[model samples]
Target: MKKKIYIYILVCTFVFRIISPAYISASTVYYDEYVTVSYVSDISGTSFPSTKTSYLWEGEHMVYKFQLSEPTIIKAYFSWSQSDEVPGGIAWFSKDMYGVDIIGNTAAISSKNKYNLILLEPGTYYINYSFGKRGSYKNAYNIGLSIAGQKVNTNTLVSASSWENPNVIRTDFYYEGFLSNLQPSAHYLFSVSSKSYVTIDYLFKQVDNLKADSAKCTLYYRNGRVIKSQKYDTRDTSKNKIAVLLEPGDYYINLSDATAPTSLYVIAEPRTNTLTQSIKRYTNKDVTVWLDSSYDHERALMVSSKVTDSNIRSNTVWKTSRNDTCLVIEEDFFTVSENGWYTVRTEDENENYVMTTINITNIDKVPPTTNIVNNKTYTSKSITIRFDDDVSGVKSAKLNGKVINYGKVVKAKGKYKLVITDQAGNAKTVVFTKK
Candidate 1:
């Protein structure tokens, strides 16, 4: 009975050890506001960093909990006053209090490795830091946290005040930011009120001897959908420019650098509709229209027309022009020689289009014909004259060089001069005798 009781006591002890929570030596620190650090531990001897924003403690491990409202890039910098007084440390990002490491040890902290740039999605996150081993000389280490893109307002739309004049390409709508080993990217938010062709121009220059290997810019819809993205080497001439057609909506621009610190100047300019006149009319002359030279690239121009009793073939022309390049379409360039309705449309590779209609009218060489109601060679009553024009409509009529209504009767019984004109300036004169 004594042996059985002892075994039962050992079994109960094992079960209690399994059921109880494990010991956690790390203390948790919560940061609710920008650059405000709050400590929750009762340890009295703990000290803080020189810069009140950083955490300085001699503990072997520490955990920081912070909430991010939007996707952000953060920089975590770890340092110590004396390199020999502290051992190396490691920091990682996790989603929960003790969740699986999302980014493990990419932020290894040592005297040589002082900082790490972390891109994080919106959520509550934990920064778990572990000083590899306490050094012989018990000294406090420091961990500083900062937001890389803090200068940008993630929720607010960049002011469109400078975009008031959409016709002119304006660089006033721009964001200037610095990138470094600590902060390698910047984010910006903007809105487009209408469908437009937008141009993004950037001036990226090296701030240090460490030249960036590559630079990239990505455009995203307000809903987190990627609209377009471009990446370029720093040496590429086209690396500084991006042009795209965007629909009306909100968007995000993320500019990133790789391997070096850079100074960035980004501009977003929305090009408005250039075709002001939708319809143009010309009579007895050649039709000519100038293409918008704002976009200095090649585009497809389609011309379609149906002329009366003519088999005119429609054609598409590719026009390439630049600031220094001139492309001229000669006079009377329409394929149709007769009068008809023509449409000229210009389209880009993205299928964005602008169009104009041309109404061409040939010369009406034939004058208006007149019909006399009283055909008698000698008439004692008044006579009525009716006028009609085929091509151009009848404009006006005059009797004896004085304005008179068309198809009106004349009561005077004497020789009279009747004149009629058409819309195309074709005039007709008649001599009649009303006796």
Candidate 2:
């Protein structure tokens, strides 16, 4: 009975924990009567003056109090110019304490907005400011109060997105962001199953006035070494690739900035499910080339291929792009090189080269000629449909009119409709009825 009661109590406690509300403190107490003002050289504390109105979950705050001589209306603003911090807090230029009528609350004070507090009858007033929390840390902030209308609040008190933010991603996603004065680096945390190859790629939208490795990115394993940028004299800013094996765990990635206010793209996913590969067709778009923008290393054609010892063809080093920090790299396999894989490496030593796999797959719009190639002529156990040309790979095969869920392996014998798809996604169906 005692054991049963203990277990019952445990279950009840768990249930209570689940149902209980999170711990939240009450708002800051308001002054009913006018508060006295005392001048200090500076508000002394680790953080800016924060009250219940402050957004700081963990930090200190500064306080200031002064008298307006008589009743007066004033415009009070928080400026970060001298303080070097963006702050959010409550400030009052007028004291309307005890009056049933309500007053101002804490709000963000920045370059764009200022708080205008009307002192119906100013005897004594207190202007308090504190630091606001940004993300998961409580950092330092210097706040400057500017009283625009009737100059009341002062004394250098201190404190301190969404898709445009460092969004968390689970599966394959392609998101674009910028590195600017506001945000210099973009950070991300992602997950992957154990023993999976994570493929990450980032490219500069505009390759002007940046080095070859100027725009860099790093993928750090949850608690392991991932990858980072490399220093190279050449200016080749082809889309950099990071293909690495990762254990099942969360990982952190930081997109390092090349130049302030530069535009870039980030593509992340498993290696097998990698995206952003351009195709080479027989006509106009035969060769896709990336250019080098620096005049010193001007026009150096950058080329890489699947073959470890790659053979780079088109070798016409041209002039660099205007204000360019990029090198020209081309991926082209003309008629002679019908089928194969191509790739290009970034400057990073540990970085995996960006792969563009080209199977030169059957672009045959027409159905592939097929014949029944099976041992023992006819068999009920299994059947094989052989096409004239080797395909990109097997897609699916069916048995009888009913579909056979044969994976890559082909099996089962009956009226079969075998659909073979090539690299370009063109499908050819072959129907064979086996006894």
Candidate 3:
């Protein structure tokens, strides 16, 4: 009785736990915000310390400091004149702890962009800006910043065309799970079972002028061998690129910029559906060619066939692009001076190739016929059969589940003797009674 009571208590605890809500820590709550910083140096003849909201060319670095009551997140935004090749800018953090540094060569940030900074336990941070060279024209911008569920400031920081932009700028706290930490120098393989082409969408940042001719693409196989190399040309202003016709296999994608070392990306899980020779046949006369195309995108259809012998007069018998499943080749008449092997291939929409073989033998193909006695009625327990042409092979007959035998060998029942031949042996069945 005591043991039963103890077991009952254990079951109650398990049930109670299953119905209970999970506990969450206070740190599980995420905080997010945005910060915008525009630099328009004193290029518009606008004087600072006057009606202008920002300084044009102070000739000194501008720093913004924030004191924190608790740890929070921050992001900075800015833009430089790309229209006239104005000096570039870079940004980084200058706090007591040297927490987070977000800096890249001077570039445009017209679109809403964000970069990550370190997670602060509790501290102050100063965002500083420096331009490479100031142009003669001051640019306009609206920098939006947010911190710990709050907006940092609404003011715009414009730089004069006379000051240089920093090498890097911007900082923010991102959701721990939201960003991908993949480096651009990694390669991976992708698998696509069907025998077809593959397309890859490549995303990259420009290292130097967009007109650089050294911007190229390099592909590497899993064995670390170079497979293909090609140059990229695009008129689209968008920053994404695409590559096509890559066989399925793990590969390394290298984006070579004229200005810097090549960046690499990984492509995992490669696959292929390639065509290979299936059979070899010898033919002096026209023969129908049949191929297997089961491993393609859809049904296999005849694409094209090439004639090797100039004297062979044969026309295309049948062809289709609507995925006929079976890859077949038909010829009106095959005429050849010499006997050799012929090749047939099937292709998918993506141009993946599948191949099959055919062998042409130098044998006579005389039509063989069957002669049935007592046309309508066959022997009660035996069937009378005769062949128009002499049958050289002896085979057994099977009906339903019973095997019938008579002598050392059996004659062909008729032209339609239901003959099935293989390398092992030959067999023919005679059906007299329906049952």
Q: Model 3: which ten-residue window has the lowest total lDDT?
A: 21-30
lDDT of 3 by residue, 1-435 (tens): 111110101124343233211111101111122123222321122211211122223112234445543322233444332332323333445452121232222223223342223222234555544333322224433222322212122111211111132111111211110001111122333343333344343433332122335455556665658766666444442333333445433444444443221222222222232232322332223444434344433333332333343312223422334434223444311232223355455445555444333444432233333333322434344444443322322333333444433321333342222232222242333333211
Q: Hey, what RMSD does candidate 3 come out at?
A: 21.1
Top TM-score: which candidate number? 1
Query: Candidate 2 lDDT (Cα, whole model)?
Result: 0.38
* TM-score ranking from best candidate downward: 1, 3, 2
lDDT of 1 by residue, 356-402 (tens): 45555654557788885322354757666788988877888888898
What's the TM-score of every candidate structure? 0.50, 0.24, 0.33
Which is superior by lDDT, 2 or 3?
2
Instruction: Tell me model 3's lDDT, rounded to 2 decimals.
Output: 0.32
Ten-residue segment with the worst summed lDDT in candidate 2?
1-10
Model 3, which residues run further than 4 Å from truth? 1-102, 106-126, 130-188, 201-216, 236-248, 252-287, 291-342, 346-354, 358-393, 396-435
Say which candidate scores most in lDDT.
Answer: 1
Q: Show how many residue pairs clash in every candidate, following the order shown.
A: 1, 22, 72
TM-score of 3: 0.33
Scored against the true structure, residue 214 in model 3 reaches a CA lDDT of 42
